[model samples]
Each structure stands twice: as structure tokens, then as C-alpha cells.
Target: MNTSDLKTKIQNLYQDILINLDIEKIDDYFAENYVQETDHDTLNLNEFKDHLQKLKDVVKSLSIEKFNDMLIDEQQRSIFLRYDVAVEKVDNSMGNIEVYAIFKFNEVGKVISCRELSKAYHEELEGLANI
Candidate 1:
């Protein structure tokens, strides 16, 4: 697929899958063997779902602020995205943090694997809560 097509896929994942938590839509987008590398560690499909469920349950309001500088390598079928997210904790505290996520697509255009690393700012929020 082309860069534009890949961009649309990521955008849909952000809006429909991540933001909306539409599990039905996920099967259509992600490969059966999809993998996730998060700040906590690496996780396979079931692990990823469990982690996402935890995030969805704990993080009250989750929103992506910006996605910029998306570079796609058609040869390698990989996409690199630099973005930031705004999240409100269950305690009603809000914070924004920078993040980077890389997606590797399979031959059929499904996301085979994804790796995401983000700045840990939850501590900062807790500190502010005390102040």
C-alpha cells in the first residue's frame, strides 16, 4: 500500500480502535499475530488486549493531541509516527506527553506489529496533585 493508505489506516486505528475501543473493528485492521512493544514491556495479542483494557478502564479521558512527521517506508512497509497525547487520569488530573509509535505492516496491509514508547509523566501529575 502507499503512504496515503497507510496514513488513513493509522488515523482510523487512532479514532475508531483506540479512541472508541471498538473491538469489532480491530480484527479487520490488525493481523492475527499482532505484537505490541510498550513502555512496560513487550506483549502479544492477548497481552495487548489486556493492557488496553486496563488503560481504557483507568484512564478516564484519553485523547491524542497531535500526530506529526509521519514517515513511511514502502520498501519496508513500516510507518513511524511522532505524536503527543492528552490524558486525564481517573483522579481528574490531566497531562500531556510526547510519544513515538512504529507500525510494521504485513503483506496484506494489516499491522503485524507495533512498538510504542512514551514519556512517563504520571509521576509529574502525582507531584502536582500534592502541591
Candidate 2:
């Protein structure tokens, strides 16, 4: 696939799948053997799916507030994205976080591996309990 198409696929993975909580479409964007690494842990495809489901359950709403940067390396078949997220949970807790994510794509354009770092800031809202 071309670089443009690969970029679009990554965008859709964030916009359509992650933000929209479209768990069923996970396989469409991620390779069957995809691996993901976060600051806390590493996960295979199935584990990643389960993680997304748990996130969906906890986060009532999520939005990509800004794309700070996006860099694509065709030779390396990798994409790096830095963005800010606005999150509101079911318990009325809210936060703004910045995330840096790197995606390595397979030859067919499906994401084969990913790594992410999230910088989260928490501010207690008056009378709002975090669950």
C-alpha cells in the first residue's frame, strides 16, 4: 500500500475504532499477530482487544483533541503520532492527556506492532468521585 493509504488506515484506527469503540473492526486494521506495548504492559492482539473493551466500559467519552505531530517513515514502514486526548468517564471524572504512539505496519498495511506512552494529568473535580 502507498504511504497515503497507510496514514489513512492509522487515522481510522484511532477515529473509527478507538474513539468510536468499534471493537469488531479491530481485525480490519490490526494484523492477527499484532503486538502492542504500553508503559504498563505488553499485549498480543487478543489481549489488546480485551483492553480496548475495558477502556470502552470505563470511558464514557473520548476525543482526540489535537494532533501535535505526525511523522511517517516509508522506508521503515512506521508512523509516529503525538496527540492530546480529552476523556470523560462514566463516573463524571475528566482529564486531558497527551499521548505518543508509534505504529509499525506490515507489508499489507495492517498494523503489526505498536508502542504508546501516555502523560496523564489528574485534577480532582469538586464533589465528583472517581470510580
Q: For each candidate, what TM-score against the reference?
A: 0.86, 0.89
**Model 1 over residues 1-131: C-alpha lDDT tens digits?**
98888888888888877677666677788898998876647778776667667666656776776686688998888999988777787878788666788999998989999887777466644322111
RMSD of each: 4.3, 4.0
What lDDT score goes with residue 122 in model 2? 68
Would you list the C-alpha lDDT of every candidate in the order shown? 0.75, 0.80
Mind giving the per-residue lDDT tens digits that candidate 2 earns over 1-131? 66797788888888877689799999889999999888646889998888888787778988886678999988889999999878888898898777789999989888999898777766632211111
Top-lDDT candidate index: 2
TM-score of 2: 0.89
Model 1: ten consecutive residues of lowest lDDT: 122-131
* Candidate 1 TM-score versus the reference: 0.86
Among residues 3 or more apart in sequence or in different chains, the pairs in candidate 1 whose N, CA or C atoms overlap within 3 Å are none
User: Clash pairs of candidate 2?
Assistant: none
